[model samples]
Target: MVVGSDGFWRLLYPIHHAETIRQAAEKNNLDPLLIASIIRVESKFRAENVSKVGAVGLMQLMPETADWIAKESDIPYRGTVDLSDPETNIHMGSWYITSLIKQFKGNRAAAIAAYNAGPGRVSRWINEGVWDGTFETSEKIPVGETRHYIQRVFFSYEKYQQLYPNF
Candidate 1:
């Protein structure tokens, strides 16, 4: 029998490092599915992944951003080396997500967009009434990459929640 589409998708989107993801998510009071989705979108579960722009590790954290997160969150951070470690990356990423969520006043879309485009730009768009900080009107976002990033992260987040409810 052919697997249903949901089952097929689940097979494709298996969660990795689930316990680490769960721990980081719980520490930050975030949904584990969200952290898993971000890791999927950012690094495709590749712990050593690094973006062209130098975002390091599974969370694709920029070195400068990671440094700031470490300082603000009081997490042990030595250098870019720390970002390559899956556990440290997850901890820092989760902390950054929580910080962004609070900064964006609990708007997950805005927070996710900020994660991709930087909070300053996202804040400007929101303050200028260019975007309402919701996925439904994402077109108003000036940066195409960030708009798409928000959509991708949200889509992955939904899929993870469906495929791994107990995660």
Candidate 2:
């Protein structure tokens, strides 16, 4: 009841796009908290942010990936420029996460790793016996960025769950 400014900001940051995140998660059959965690890690809820590698919006979707998802899902894509729009970006990103989850057979950690490292690479690592695609073994993920990414997302997810149980 007595949350300070810092705590309030922390709570607000992850839930800034609550409506869009909830809608996207529901449509994609994903946990809204997971989406919020990803948004927190990817863009800190900044809809206009763009990564150095051209990832755009709150979900940080790359242009080519967005186009491919649009083609695969038959969703009308207005091009990467629209990725700056929170609703469009959240929907597309949520769809992508669902697709990745399916590809990895519901292995959330592997799917999340793929989201950062690419499915092909994750599959290769699994096939080659490099990493077992489990959270416990994520430390062995060869890609440092992806390994840290998975940890960060999971950490944020835990925080979200704690801070907003209803999320």
* Candidate of highest TM-score: 1
How well does candidate 2 match the true structure in TM-score terms? Answer: 0.93
| After superposition, candidate 2 runs with Cα above 4 Å error | 1-13
The lDDT for every candidate, in the order shown, is: 0.90, 0.91
| Alpha-carbon lDDT of model 2 | 0.91
Cα lDDT for residue 129, model 1?
Answer: 93
User: In angstroms, how far off is 24's CA in candidate 2?
Assistant: 0.5
Per-residue CA lDDT of model 1 for 28-126, tens digit only, reads: 999989988888889899999988899999999999999899779878889999899999999999999999999999999999999999999999998
What local lDDT does model 1 show for residue 33?
Answer: 90
lDDT of 2 by residue, 1-167 (tens): 35665477565555887888889889899999999999999998889999999899998999999999998885558998889988889999999999999999999999999999999999999999999999999999998999999999998898788788877
Q: In angstroms, how far off is 120's CA in candidate 1?
A: 0.2
Consecutive 10-residue window with the lowest summed lDDT within model 2: 1-10
